[model samples]
Target: MTVTNADRESLRHGKITERPLRDKPGYPSWAIKLVMAVTGLIFALFVIGHMAGNLKLYMPAHDGVAALDEYGAFLRTMGAPLFPYESILWVIRIVLLVALVAHIHGAITLISRSGKSRGKFRRTNLMGGMDSAATRSMIVTGVIILLFLLFHLADLTLGLSPAAPETFEHGAVHANMIATFSRWPVVLLYVIANLALFLHLFHGIKLAASDLGITGRRWRVVFSWLAALVPLIVVAGNIIMPLSVLFGWVS
Candidate 1:
């Protein structure tokens, strides 16, 4: 077989190219960003709903407890007859759990990749100002929020924490909240955790928007305001409830 110069050139051109190590076959960076974005949005919605529900504590004592308790019952009975009691709530819980895992995994993967690519001495300060800090501290805040979530569940949902209310009631969410937040230490913990949550959500919303291609230059300012506003509202609302309980405003 005689090979011509043209044939050699064609063969050379047809050789498989190697991609960068980080771009190897697995979940691509875009896919990971998508997962992070979607899961973050889910969590954001949940936070908003949760904060709104918590604000029910501001109602008059008799009305507030009854309203909060009824709200709790409503969640459990969400799909009665067609579905078992608490089935919908459980389903939501499972979905949120999956999202949480995926979000964490994606975040860790991205951070590791970024750290390796940028090397140790790269200046992260060039990214932005406050937004950069929020972005950089995402993992820190995320871990804090995760720990706080476990404590929150133990303290309120399961009544398993040493700090849990002395008297546990099935549907009395208002009473439970008051009992928990009435303690100064618990109130302080909640405030700190919520501040972390605020930072996380602030960066998360902007990142999600950017990931989803919502970053038209004209719209950037709008998105930035929204990112800041939404988390502030949620955190403020949440902080108010605990502060109210601690100060006897809601008692």
Candidate 2:
């Protein structure tokens, strides 16, 4: 008796399984998903931390230095005398870049493989419209987030051209934020990007949970709420900052 691909799939109940790495020509789908899950979690944690740090924009300045500025300085000088100035920050940036590249590679590869595997027949749409839509929009939302990241880096971190306001000042995080968000267009851009971030985070969290094997009913329910709540908090925290700056509430 011969077992067909359908027989194997049925036996597996559509669950993703890993094959021995030695037998594969390239990284397997499960490995790609695991890479995406881990990298996505890294990004999710970083954004949450970043959003919390940005919230210091609301704190009162001490000795003429904004608390947000202090936070920014702390990030650069973290691991201080034990390490050279900005070394820790550079290390973090390098790690984040590597993760970003791996995550993107995994997404593109999985997408290509999925498309190729679907050759002549459409898979049964068991997950319904919302999940299906989110699955489809993954690439679009991912691209939006990617563009937003580059713009954010240029506008704030590097203080580079048109993205950065004329009032942009190095090491003046609070002031720079105020100056940047004071522009309606910039605020609008931030609003749109954060909205995209919200969608991306929401779907990505749930997907990552599934990828990581959270299939128990109770756990899935818990993750569903978490998937929504985490992104909501992060996006709300981030979106409010620019809005507050734009509205003259923070400055």
lDDT of each: 0.86, 0.88
Candidate 2's TM-score reads 0.87
**Steric clash pairs (candidate 2):** none
Segments of candidate 1 deviating more than 4 angstroms: 1-23, 61-65
TM-scores of all candidate predictions against the true structure: 0.87, 0.87
- In the range 1-251, model 2's lDDT, one tens digit per residue, is 56568657765885554654335446889999999999999999999999999999888899988999999999989998999999999999999999999999999988888777787778676686556776767788899989989999999988998999988889998888988899999889888888888888888989888899999999999988988899999999999998998888878
* Model 2 regions more than 4 Å off: 1-24, 123-125
What are the per-residue Cα lDDT tens digits for candidate 1 across 13-80?
Answer: 97543445555737788999988999999999999999988776666546434677777888999988
Residue-level error in angstroms, candidate 2, position 6: 17
Give the C-alpha miss distance for residue 205 in model 1, angstroms: 0.6
* Sliding window of 10 residues with minimal summed lDDT for model 1: 16-25
Say which candidate scores most in lDDT. 2
Cα displacement (Å) at residue 242, model 1 = 0.9
